[model samples]
Target: MKYMKWPVLLGILFIHAVAAAQVPVVTLGPDFAEPGDGWDKLMQLKNGNTFYLHFSRKEGLVVNVYNAGHELTVTDTVHAQLWNTADIESTEIDGIFEINGQPVLFLQQLVKYNPVLYRLVLDGVSGKLVREDKLGELPSVQFRSVFVDDNLASHDFYVEKDPESDYYAVALFSGMPVQKTDSIHERIQVMHFSPRHELLHQGWLYMPDTTYSYFSYINMAVNGKEKVYLGTVGFNTKRNGSEIKPKVIFSALSPDSATFAHQVLDYTAGFANVGGTIQVATSTANVYMLLHVPAKQGEGNSSIILNTFQLSTGKLQKHVQLVFPELARNMEMNLGYKDTYKGTPQRFMLNQDGTSTLLLENFSFFKQGNTQINKLHTNLGDIGIALLDTAGKENTTMAVSKYQVITGICEPFQLQRRSKSEWMFRNKIAALNTNTYLSYDYIPGQSAAFVLFNDYLQYLDTGGQDRVRKPLKYAVDANFVCYRFYNGKMERLFLFGMPEVTKGYACMMGAADYNAAVGTYATLLISRKGLEKKANIAWIKF
Candidate 1:
């Protein structure tokens, strides 16, 4: 890799930081109309075509077909009965995938208050719907977000794709009840599909004692057509069922078996896996999970225990207790994060050397004020990375400094249903939430791993606290930063000069697309020069 002077390397300079790295050639496309609400997803098909999928509540699915040069050719709204439902709340984007060179979108509709799953296949080149089919349905069950709060929205239905193969698993959990009692029971269903969206395995997971024990949805993963793993903490009551003792369990659904194989990882009242999740290593047949152990009678610091389980047999392989101070020392990071902090696992990367690295997001959620003047704050930002060997031993840890927030008047969007929902309203339709632009994307490579995010420029030093007590002005100071990881260390460089990046255009990193085989990453750089914001796809090679 050779270094060259970038012509657009504007006034803001970090001469020594980049060390004269090769600047990626960027090509901008023609401007188009700005999209509406819901979410935006970009996908690159195998035929070298791209689809800019815009899913909204009132307008349904809008597809934009772009050529290899990133020029928009075709733009149309998908004409499907399920897609354009009369009531927008009834339809939800279950999952989106590019299957066999065509864009596949799984949609869920609550028809007559019952959930039904539908799949729509769009033309890879034209962005037009070719086929629509009814996949399956679930009756007498409640489907909703697993963790719905003022700032966070977690879905109960998720799709996990196999990194090594074309196999994928679609799983949805719902609250089931009306058992002539008050408590509503929980039920989960799984469906496995092949490369061409062929059904391979389907069944309802036997979570636990349907009556005595209730489970909390945590995470899910799928392996090459053979297994769909579901992680949950089963809660059971004692002495006439008045309380609940949490037990972390992993259930595997295979094609050859008629029922799920269950393995209990933790069954103690002293510890809980409330916010923990599972990571299936692609290099080896092992699944990793972190269990939080609170201080024993308030004597010592809290502990994070890592448990390794065999993927094939659903058995415990090994367990290790990590030292927080030592791990922080290795990363050269601060332990105190504005008095109190938390580490939540957000992603897992499988290295070529059979070691898996776990990435933890540092954040906290708390409420302030009394009843009439209450507010909930999801204080997010900052990161922690733990490198674990094959035996679940912690080899190293890394911490990242960040600062982001969401606030203002939050009013409840009332639905006919009993559950309350909060919708943060903005005055204009085209104006999006600033926090949406302050997102990150990750791409793993053969030689080095890359992370793309936006944060303050002053937080470049690694020794200070990752997050401060008072929130920083991310909207004014945010800049695109790229982190390259290799040889057990990392380097941070601004993707572009500040003057060039502040030119009304911002990268929608949350909707970025990456091709591991070709080593190219694409994202829509939306320009805010006018009310009609224009979008251009920016592609960079690794």
Candidate 2:
């Protein structure tokens, strides 16, 4: 691969001049004139020849269709009800390969005080209702994210299980209940459905005891062998109070969910009272857990622990602890450094070659009077690339320069390998009062790393030893990057979306190209918007 230098490069200068000549054109469509106060949820769906957008307002939920020319072709009012009663909390569209091989849109309707889970499927072509099925009585469970697997004939569902049940007792509480009833085991249920929506597997995870106190968050992941990794919170009730332990339990299931094997990862045993997130990447067999330790509890400074475990051997490779040194010095740093902290060391980017980069944010403090106020002035996030040597005793650690001061927010968006020595990072940057976000893809292949940011990708070229800014004419929203030689000129292809501004929050943008089949590709955007908000998915075709 040929590595290009940044800044002083003639190619960058030429591109900048071309980008300056191109004006951003914004074409507005017909207004969605629904009498509503706040527009909360928005989802975009693309079929073969059409695009569908579904949005919810204070009034009801509406669906609008558009063509490739950006013209609104069809409008459908899916459902309407009184302001307080009707609510569509979640909507998912899946391209089902079976059953006539059509795409189906599943909308989950939730009444404010009801416990029923309503399911509705919309036809992909006509935008009409194909079928509606009531998914029976559900628990008083809060809404979580949903997933649909096309290759597999089952839909895996996960929800918060009740803590007072016998299943909860065995799986989490670490103690058995005095009295066990039939209803106790039915408190929490994990349901798996067949292709035709038939119940395949439904049962509760056996717990130790039926205690009112248990861990809060529960996340599920399926490994290569189809074993379910249930990352959950476990609690122990002693003479004092309930102590929470963050644990990842692996459960092996047979085809019918009748026979199973279970094991708890002992590496995560000591993690107590920490409430963070866990993600497992099957391709790399790496499990990353973000732990939030409380500072006031004398648990030391709050930090994120990156645990690398092998799926084949079920052994932990390395446990790296990430902590913001500056943030730890501030007395005003509360538990988990929730307030007055920009970002934690939880941001991670896993490379293809088993190497990874971790992004950590630190904060400084200033004394006003009797009270001390911690201010996030500097972003101490550095990219640490770790490579395991054959001896395993000598692990190489390559640290990059610290990033610019990003106030109170930072995230690892995209990490691309430019060359043998260089890597590129496209991070989503945001600050206070500045809603605009940009992408900075750093090319580490060359001597002077070049960072591509926003429309004008800026880079530092060692060839000229100067900084240069150029306009990258490719569309910004799509995940896939295309380069082609047309008429002796390099042409880039991209799909553009509406520009959005972040409000008092930072966002992490991620993009990847997945090959669905031969000559077919899907561009996916896995973006984490707000810290507390859910990660949204946007898929486009090229």
* Number of the top-ranking candidate, with TM-score as the measure: 1
Q: Model 2: how far is 40 from its true place, Å?
A: 6.4
Cα miss at 124, model 1 (Å)?
2.1
For residues 274-341, write the lDDT of model 1, one tens digit per residue.
54445677567677765544332132233555677787787887777644444445334343444323
Q: Give the TM-score of candidate 1.
A: 0.77
Worst 10 residues of 1 by lDDT: 412-421
Expressed as tens digits, the lDDT of each residue in 1-542 for candidate 2 is 11111122223223232331222222233433322221222223344323333333333445455444545676676652222224333322211111222223322333443344334455555555566555534333343322111111111223221111101101111112212343444434445443344554654554535432233333443332233334444433353254534354443333345433345556665554443444455557665444444331234433455555565444566665543333322212212223333344333444434544443333222232231222333332322322232211213222221223323323222122111001111112222212112233222221121122233222212121111323122222212222221121322322233223321112122222222231222111222233323222233322
lDDT for position 9 in model 1: 19
Give the whole-model CA lDDT for all candidates, comma-separated: 0.58, 0.32
Question: Which stretches of candidate 2 lie above 4 Å from their native place?
Answer: 1-46, 49-51, 68-71, 80-85, 88-114, 136-185, 194-198, 208-213, 223-225, 237-262, 265-302, 309-319, 322-342, 345-542
